[model samples]
Target: MATLDLSAHLKEAKKHGPQARGISDMARSLVGSEILRIAGEVKAFAAQGNKVLDLTVGDFSSKEFPIPQPLEEGIIRALKAGHSNYPPASGVIECREAVRQMFERRLGLGYPVGSVLIAGGARPMIAGIYYALCSPGDKVVYSLPSWNNNHYCTLVGAEKIEVPTRPESQFFPRAEDLAPHLGQARLLCLNSPQNPTGTVIDRDALSQVCELVLAENKRRQQAGSPPLYLMYDQVYWMLTFGGVTHHTPVSLYPEMAAYTIFVDGISKAFASTGLRVGWAVGPTDVIERMSAILTHLGAWAPRPEQIATAELLNNGPAVDSYLAQMNRNLFTRLGKLSGAIEALKGKGWNVDCISPQGAIYLSLKIDLRGKKTAEGKLLRSDEDTRKYLLEEAGIALVPFLCFGLAEDTGWFRASVGAVSLADCDSFQARLTGALEKLS
Candidate 1:
C-alpha cells in the first residue's frame, strides 16, 4: 500500500495555527543540555577527519577505559540466563540490596534496602527528585558550575537560588554562603568530586554544610513547614585523587540522613555508562515518591545490567582492584593535561587550571578574552575562545558556561574520558602554537 506524503502538511501546520504552541508549556520551555550541544559539534568537527582531541563530553571511550571485567562477564552471563524481562519499577531486589550493602561496606552508611530505588542511570534520579519534591515557585539552592541543577529546576518550575562560588573554594559553596539560601529553599543539591571542576569538598567544609541542613530542618519543624531535602549527587565520589578524600553529609552526621539523598551509579564509578544502572538512597517516603515519578516514566534499569552490577558491587576485591587501576590511568591522563596547561601559565600566557583532585575533568581557564586572534578578530567570550582553540589548535573542550555558568567566565572543563594520555599531551604542542597567534 502506498503511504500518503504528510511532510508538506506538517511543515505548513508549523507556519501557523495551534501547531506553533502544540507542545506542553513545560516541554516547550525546557532547555536542552548545552554540554550535549557542544559535544555534538565536536563530534561533527572530528567526523570531518580533522585531528581534533575531543575533551567535551564526560563520557568514556570504551577502547581506552572499558567497564570492569567482572561486570562485563556478569552481563553476558545474565543475558545468557534469559534475564531479559522488564525489571521491577524500583529495580531488582538483589540489586537494591547490593547497593545498600556496598554503601554500608564502602561508605559506612547503613540503610535498609527499601530506601534504595534504582533507575536508568543518575539522570532519572535527579529528575525524579525534582518532580517528587518541588512545586512551582519552590526554591532550589545549587552551586554555580553544578552539572544540571538549573535545568532540573526549570523542569520542575522551581526558583533557582544560584550560589556563585569562587576558584579559591574550588567552586564549592561554603556553609555560610548556603545558609541564607537553605532557610526557605525546598531543595539543596551538592556534588562531590564535582563534575566540570574536578574538585572535592574537604571534610570540614562538608560537615559545616551538613550542620546547616540540620539547622534548617529544625526551623522548618518549628514553623510547621515541610523539611528541606538535600540531593547529594556523588556519582563521581569514587573517582577522587591526589590525596583528597570524598566526604558525605550522612557520613559526617547521621542526623543529616533524614534530609540527605544520595544519587550514585556505576555509570561514573565503574565506567559503565551504557549499563544504565543507578540508585537513589534516602528516606523511604521520598524514595517512594521518586519511585512513583520514575515508574510513570518507566525509568528503571535494565534487568540484565542490574543483575550484573549487583554481582560487581557485591565483590569487594573486584571493585577495589578495578578502582586502583582506573585511578592510575586517570591520574596519568590528568597529569599530562595539567602539566601542559601549567607550562603555558609559566610562559606568561593568560591560562590556568585547578590541579586535578577528582573526576575525569580538569578546570582549565583559557583567559584570552580581549586578545585579537591572528585573523585580527577579537575574542570576546568563552564561545569565541572555544572556537578559536578548536579552529587553531584542534583541541576541543566544553566551557563552564555549558555547566550553568551564565557569564563570560574563561573556565572550561577538560574531560580526559574520551581521549588517551597521548591525546592529552598533544594539547600542549597544539595549544602553544595556537596561542602564539594571539596579540
Candidate 2:
C-alpha cells in the first residue's frame, strides 16, 4: 500500500486546485472595488488599536444610526407571522403596492403596481436594468466621479462614455454635458443627491435633462432605432438638506415617463443598507423585462424585510419622523466637517469643501499635492494625500479616484452615515494638526 508522502501530496493538491484555475475573460477584465480596497487599509489601521475615523464606506453603522423603530418592529412581526418563504419574483404584492403609493404620495408620480420591480437591493435592480436594456457594445453614458456606473457598464460589456463633470456644476451632469453622447448612447445613467458629492439636480437642470432625453428619444423613433433609456437613481432623494429639493425626470417632463426608469430603495433613506430591499419604477415593458431577469437571478428581497419596509413606507408619520431625525444627524456631521475644512481654507491651508446640500456625504478638497510632509515626503497625488491623512490625521476617507475620477483629482468623499458628531469634531482637530505639519 502506498501510504506515501501525504504532506507532499496535500501541498501539490493545494498548488493545483480548481479554485486556482483561470477565470473567464469578462471576469478577468473586471476591477475589484477600489473603495473596498482602501477600506481594508483602514481596517488594518483600526486593528492596531488606533482610533481611525473610517468614512470610506457608503453604509450605515447600525449602532450609530439604527434602522427606524417601526421598520425593526415590522420585521419582527413579519417573521413571527412566518414570512420566511420565497417572495414573489417581482415582490410581495403588499410591498409593491406600498412602493406604488410611496411614489404617488411623495414624488407626485403615479406609477402602477405593474411598473414596479423590487429586488435584493439597488445593485441588483441596477444590474437588471443593464441586462434588460443595454446589449453588448451599446454606449452607456454617465458622469465620472459618480458611483458604480462604470463597473456596471463593464459587467454588461457596454461602451462607457464618461462625461467629466466640473465642480461648478456641483459635480452633476448638465444637459449640455450629456447632449453629445445622447445621440449615440443606449442608456443614460443619472444619480441625484448624487453619491460621493452629496449634490442634487435642481428643477431647471433636471428639466433640461428630461428635455434632452425626450428629444433624443424622438430622434431615435424617427430613425427606427431603439430609444435611449434613462436610469435615474434617486436612492438618496429623501436625504436632501437645506433648501435642496429632489427633482425627478418624469415629474419635469411627462414625455420622459416612456424612457425613464427610477431606481430607489430604503437602503439609504431608512439606514437599512443591510436589510436588502430596493425597487425600480418605470415603463411597464421595461420593468417587465427587468423582473424577468431578476427572477432568473433570484434577487427578490427577503419576504420579512419587504413586508417591514412596506409597513414603514406606508406609515406616513413614522416615515416623516425617521427622516427628520436622520436628516438632522447627517446634516450636523456634514456641516461640522465642511465648516472645519472651510476654517482650514481661511488660514491659507490647502483645504476646501463644497457645501453639502444633500445625502450623508461632503466633498472635501485636500490639495496637498506638491506639499512636503514633516518627514520630507512630498505628496504628489491624491493617493499620497489619502495616505498622509489616514496615517497623520487618523482621517480616513475615499478619494474621488475610487469613484472613477482621474487619479489627480484632489476631491474626496467623507460619508457621515457611520460616524458621530463627536467623531467629526475629533477628526477636525486631528486634521488641523496634520495640516499644520505640512511645510
Q: All candidates' lDDT scores?
A: 0.91, 0.91
Q: 1-439, model 2: which lDDT tens digit per residue?
A: 9767699878887786544655666776788999989999999999998899888879999988899999999999999999989998999999999999999999999988999988999999899999999989999999988899988988999999999998888988888989988888999999998999998888888888888888888888899989999999999999999878898999888788899999999999999999999999999999999999999999999999999999988999999999999999999899999999988899888788889899889999998999899999999999999999999989999999988887577899999998988898887799988988998
Q: Write the per-residue lDDT of candidate 1 for residues 200-267, one digit (tens) a residue.
A: 99998899998888888898899898999999999999998899899989988999888989999999
TM-score of each: 0.97, 0.96
Using TM-score as the measure, the top candidate is 1
Alpha carbon lDDT of residue 141, candidate 2?
95
Error of 1 at 284 (Å): 0.8
The candidate 2 region of ten consecutive residues with least summed lDDT is: 16-25
- Runs of candidate 1 exceeding 4 Å displacement: 1-4, 17-19
- Residue pairs with colliding backbones in model 1 are none
